[model samples]
Target: MSNLSQLLKESWVLVEERHDDVAAHFYARMFLTDPGLRQLFPVHLDTQRRCLVEALVTAAASIDDPERFTEYVQGLGRAHRKFHVQPSQFAAFHGALLEALRTVGGDRWTIEYDQAWADALGLLTSNMITGLEQDADPAFWHAEVLAHERRGADIAVLTCQPLQHPLRYQAGQYVSVEVPRYQPRLWRTYSIANAPRPDDTVEFHVRAVGAGWVSSALVRRVRPGDLLRIAAPMGTMVLDRESPRDIVCLAGGVGFAPIKALVDELTRFNRSRWVHVYLGARHRDELYDLDELLRLAATYPWLNVVPCCTDDPSWTGEHGEVSEVLARYGPWHEHDFFVSGSAPMVRASLRTLAELEIPADRIRYDSFGDI
Candidate 1:
């Protein structure tokens, strides 16, 4: 790792526990410095605050891996186009971030830490700008909702077709969607639940939680024929087809979206590799996509599907958290692991994988905390 990377990670730890406060401070300084920037964000700053802190942490964690870091920030830059972020605004953001860091660090702050962060931010901004400039694609795609089905009171599955150019994306990637009809200017990310199709259509699984503005609109209010805006796809959790190792996929609740897409893609040419999918939910009613996954498993000889329920005693299949069920089946040292789920579930599964002695490189994951 580079000296700046170590410094960046160490400096971040000082303010990590106070992430919410840090986000609040950063935004306050940013809007104070450039009041016009305030209009770019939502009226409710709760989700935006969490997103800011998550972005900072993700950037810091990936800094030591130049390729991964560049890919991440560049994708972030491209995705930010949906917000109409201008290149000039980056300076104000950087200045506010530095100020926020210094204020949060207090007496522990030093010149070396400031310099390292400045350098890190410089790299982040420059790569993001490059991604922005190199992108010839539209900032957002106009998609028409073709179908919507309520899986339960809180969950829904929807499909949409991009009206103009094809929406090309890898199976496990997700796109930021905006339902302007109901929640204007509020966007949330949803994984494309199916592999790319010739008809330029995509699927999403949504579960409305708490007072999520976008998720509620998507699950309950939005209907077929309504128009939605979709930003460019972003995520690095796609399949590694070249790896000779067998695969184990873990999905919790609606995190099945990406896992289903991956399994779909694998079905195309997977002849030799064994693929096991462990789908988990609190109750059997929550495993909305279990039937479809079972049908797929029955059709493919190499595919195996295990449905796990934590809260349902009537369930005849596996009983336990997905991670716990996975633990019983492991000796997974040689298999590649893909995990997608709620933050807590993902964290638990990762901890289990670490305990099982799985190499870090053999595992890839996507965790949905809020959206």
Candidate 2:
């Protein structure tokens, strides 16, 4: 291993057990150093702390692989841009992080360990700065909500029109949305729910999760003519139309957003390749877009839609988790798989597909955090 990787791993091992405390210290020191920076984040620091710990651990573990580590850091940097992260902020964050590590390490810290951490942070932050510089699109787009349809009590489908310039994105990419009501500056990423439209319009499926500030505002407070700011599209879940392989899409709950967009893209070209979709929800009532799926399936003979319910006993439709339901359909060996939903669902689906011998390269997914 390189000196940078070895040092990071060794140092992280000492701090791993007290990661939460370290993260807490890092933020505390950060705000104390620059009090104004505190306003940039949410009031609750628990989730942010967890994210920082996870990121540090992941970076340390992956540091041996230069290409993968660089890609990961670049994506991390791009995601941070949606929050209006500035290049000038990197140094303060780096210093605070190093201080946290030293505070946690106590006598365990040495000059060598400090140098390694500084080097590692320099690499990560430099790449992040490069990522920020690479983006040519506007920081945010102004979109007017054209219509909002409540699919269920907790789900809303928003149709929006960009007010200034067209928002360019692939079939299955997501955009970070900022709603005015919830925590003013907080922005959340939601996958685009349809293929690119001729009118440059976009759709998003927002499901209100418990204590989800932006989602709750989008689904409960957003109305027609309401203006919202959207960051440039992010994510690489888009379909590879060049591939001749058939597709198997596994979607759970609101994870259907990007999967639907991919399927819609395929149907538009009347692609002869067969596409199978396994959409699941906890209750039949939660399968809010069944009609839309059914209509698309009918319109495209090559596409098959299977709806599954995990907890609804009264429903006569296929009953089981989407991954379990997928086992009934044989031979996914030749097909590419797209899995999305809550993190548990995605992890489960990936494990199942791996067991079925589907190559990892052929699977595409967008992690939706804990949703």
Write down the lDDT of every candidate, Cα atoms only: 0.91, 0.86
Using TM-score, give the best candidate's number. Answer: 1
Where is the poorest 10-residue window by lDDT in model 2? Answer: 180-189
lDDT of 1 by residue, 337-365 (tens): 99998999999999999889999999999
For residues 1-371, what per-residue lDDT tens digits would candidate 2 score against the true structure? 88778888888888889999899999999889878788888777766787698778777777888886887787678767766778998888899999999999889988999999988888889988887778777778889999999988999999999877888889988887888655577677789999999999999988998888788889989999998988878776888878899889999999999999998888788556899999999998899998999998898889998999989889999999999999888788999888989878998899899889999889989767522
TM-score to native of every candidate shown: 0.98, 0.90
- Pull out the clashing pairs in model 1: none
lDDT of 1: 0.91
**Number of clashing pairs per prediction, in order:** 0, 0
